[model samples]
Target: MVLCAGASQPPQSSQTLLAGVGDSSRASLSSGNEGGRYELTPERRALLNTIRYAEGTWKDGEDKGYQIMYGGGQFQDLSRHPERVIVKRYTSAAAGAYQFLPKTWKGVAQELRLSSFEPRHQDQAALHLAERRGALDEIDRQGLTKDAMAKLAPEWASFPTKAGHSAYGQPVKSHQELASFYSSNLRQLRNQLGA
Candidate 1:
């Protein structure tokens, strides 16, 4: 299980998942341009935030999780993917808010034209991955659906499929739990947007 910074024993599953499932970049530090053509609508924002929540990268809605490395280590550099392999119970190159593996981050960064591991770039990379998995349309049109979650399962081991299991055989959050969080998060985002 992934530990938070300064924690001795592993936190409960509800607190963090194994940093082994899924796996970004260094372009723009500005979040505004990070979205690029993909609009960061409230629905999309909530969806990305929900993914962060599942990946154990969320903390008080801030960017603290953006620097979190595998095994709860924090990387000081944000200009590019850390590409650092942290070995605890598992070996992983995953870092950033989405916990992207080295290869996965490389691929996504190339695909999305991302330049840095900044918070917004990380967010964009995750969204691009979701879109590649054919889940973005469903997420934009209907919030989080079972099929959407299933599509994202391979991209993120923390997301549950219809069977409520991690696609990568790692630990996962329940669909119901995710849906509940999504609904609440969506509402919060919509409110912020005055939508």
Candidate 2:
């Protein structure tokens, strides 16, 4: 998580602190800003939420995680992905709920044409990564199966491989814990759809 040389960051004074953004209901998926492309199915939403939970960014189940920087800091602007690197306990350019590294976000954003680091785009980026790793179909059909999680482990350090260790040697959530979280999250997302 070393900050590469010449990486860009906003001036400290210019970074506006956001107190919080409310829960999952706060951002409407039907906003039409980037319709169809970023639309999330319930399974996709649950998978992303579980990843957020594992990443320690599922802050109060709110949109707050969408604004979160690495090391538990928040950035205000949603107009673009914050490529700012932070060097608290760990040096990283990772931001948003899925904890995307700057390079990773840039590639995903470019491929998906995501204009902002808003919650929906973040969700879509996660999905795109999963899709690229060939785990999306399994998640859609089987929820968070071990095979799916294993395929995604390399893409997301918080996800465990089949042997139950992070692909990146970082800490990982247990399969049981992630499975429980995904199940509950999927049920909640489905209920929201019905409502």
Candidate 3:
């Protein structure tokens, strides 16, 4: 196809044209945005709380992958992990409420800000990653599914599964426990989207 003089079509990546698809998540973000921004809600708060329980405690300067706590303490002895006390099963020595690796954090933190690595900022960064990954929309629509859980699993090790555990943890909560955690909000969240 050729463009007419002074008339042109929008540019699309040749790879996207070949695939017959654009980045639909980003497309949705642009078009279907709720007031054009993400905001905190009960569902999100509950979700973060669940992640915190899994991350265990703060170390270095982050909690779960969040810099939730402030007020300085001694520097880490030698471990790269944020916490002096270590918990394995993670693929990286990540920090914060969402356990972002140093490189990842630096990039995200810079985009978000150079100052104030507080809980709110950390939550925003985590949500930014989650939304970019397409998990937030999936969870909003499906409540929780194997696929949605899988999408979110990479971000939060303890995102639950129906099988009495999560993809990354060693059974932090029981089957009943998991159900209760989701039960209170799942219906409400699903109802919010007519899911």
TM for candidate 3 is 0.51
Better of 1 and 2 by TM-score: 1
- Candidate 3 residues lying further than 4 Å off, grouped into runs, are 1-37, 57-92, 160-179, 185-195
TM-score of 1: 0.82
- Model 1 per-residue lDDT tens digits across residues 97-156: 888887888887788888888877787788888898999999989989989999998888
- Candidate 3 worst ten-residue window by lDDT: 1-10
How many clashes show up in model 1? 9
Per candidate, the number of residue pairs that clash is 9, 0, 11
Ranking of all predicted structures according to TM-score, beginning with the best and ending with the worst: 1, 2, 3
Residues 87-140, candidate 3, lDDT per residue (tens digit)?
333234455555555566667667766344454555566667767667777656
Q: What is the lDDT of residue 127 in candidate 1?
A: 82
- Alpha-carbon deviation at 115 in model 2, angstroms: 1.4
Candidate 2 least-lDDT 10 residues:
11-20
Per-model TM-score on C-alpha atoms: 0.82, 0.81, 0.51
On the 0 to 100 scale, the lDDT of residue 167 in model 2 is 84
- Candidate 3, residue 12: lDDT: 26
